[model samples]
Target: MDRRTLLTLGLGGGVAVLALGAGVAVRQVMESRRAARVTGTKLGAPFRLTDHNGQPITEAAFQGRPSLLFFGFTHCPEICPTTVYDMETWLSEMDVAPEALGAYFVTIDPERDTSEFLKSYLEPQSHRILGITGEPEAVWDMAKSWRVYFQKRPLDGGDYTMDHYASIFVLNARGEVVDLIPYGTAADEAKAKIAAVL
Candidate 1:
């Protein structure tokens, strides 16, 4: 081969290598961003709470399977039920098997949400959706451990409303908090997030 031809081939090969490297780097960055947006924080934070069955639920229950946990009460007319329904729908649509993922509804209004009530409420939604409720103090302690916030507001009719943060937590198989999906997250995005972790 001529010297000029050899030099041209060498330059072309180097350019191709660089382009491939750039493409790989771009793909990695995009995946990282998608994961971050889906799960807001790192997993493995020690969290203790009660399960809907009145059992002593802890982070350990979330172990062995990926979990999607939402902290809200059954009384939440808008955001709580809506988010649960969305998650159920998305999970049903997923190609993954149900055994690979778990869903939880942790109540902020423990005083009002008994185990029976929780079971009744979630029965129609999903058999896999576990409901958790405990003493007010225990619930508060768990909320504080997870950096969740909630408060009760008294109404004029002597009733009260429980105000709480609405964010879905995605925990990995190891029971670590891997990520968070903010309220109003689309079904597709939520499903994508859960699938990524699983």
Candidate 2:
């Protein structure tokens, strides 16, 4: 072949090799992620925090029982309370025994959501749903570990509000993330997801 033809062929072969390598890399990553999902590997890091009753708790609390976790602040005007109520309804409809499941409302606003405050805020809604809060840094660290997002939004007055993830994390008995029931999911759909972990 001429020099021009030889050069073109060499460039084309190089591109083909690069494309093959890229495809292999992508497949490996996809397979790894699929294996993680299938094996139900632990998705959140360990943490130490206090329950609503002022008792110390750890990630170990999630082990040995299916659990549901959601991140929100009590001061939230609408979504937080509504989500908690939805959680109660789903569990009740599913006939999930209180002892058979672990449901936690973890505070994204630790500055205002103390253990006592969480207790009072949660008591009337559902006895089965527990509250979790801790030092601001610790709470934020735990939230980060769980891949939760939150930010403070300034209001006209001196007060402020929080914007945060509103989905419920469904975890299996091994603390593996089974699914996330997004905000506004239908009650029946939520029940089905939670039932899977149970």
The lDDT for every candidate, in the order shown, is: 0.69, 0.78
**How many angstroms is residue 100 displaced in model 1 relative to the true structure, after the best TM-score fit?**
0.9
Go through the candidates in order and give the C-alpha RMSD of each one to the true structure.
Answer: 16.8, 13.9
Name the 10 consecutive residues with the lowest summed lDDT in model 2: 9-18
For candidate 2, write residues 88-183 as lDDT tens digits.
988888888999999999998999999999999998999999999999999999987876656676776698877666677788888877676766
Candidate 1: stretches off by over 4 Å: 1-49
Error of 1 at 124 (Å): 1.4
Q: How many backbone clashes does candidate 1 have?
A: 9
Error of 1 at 1 (Å): 63
TM-score of each: 0.74, 0.82
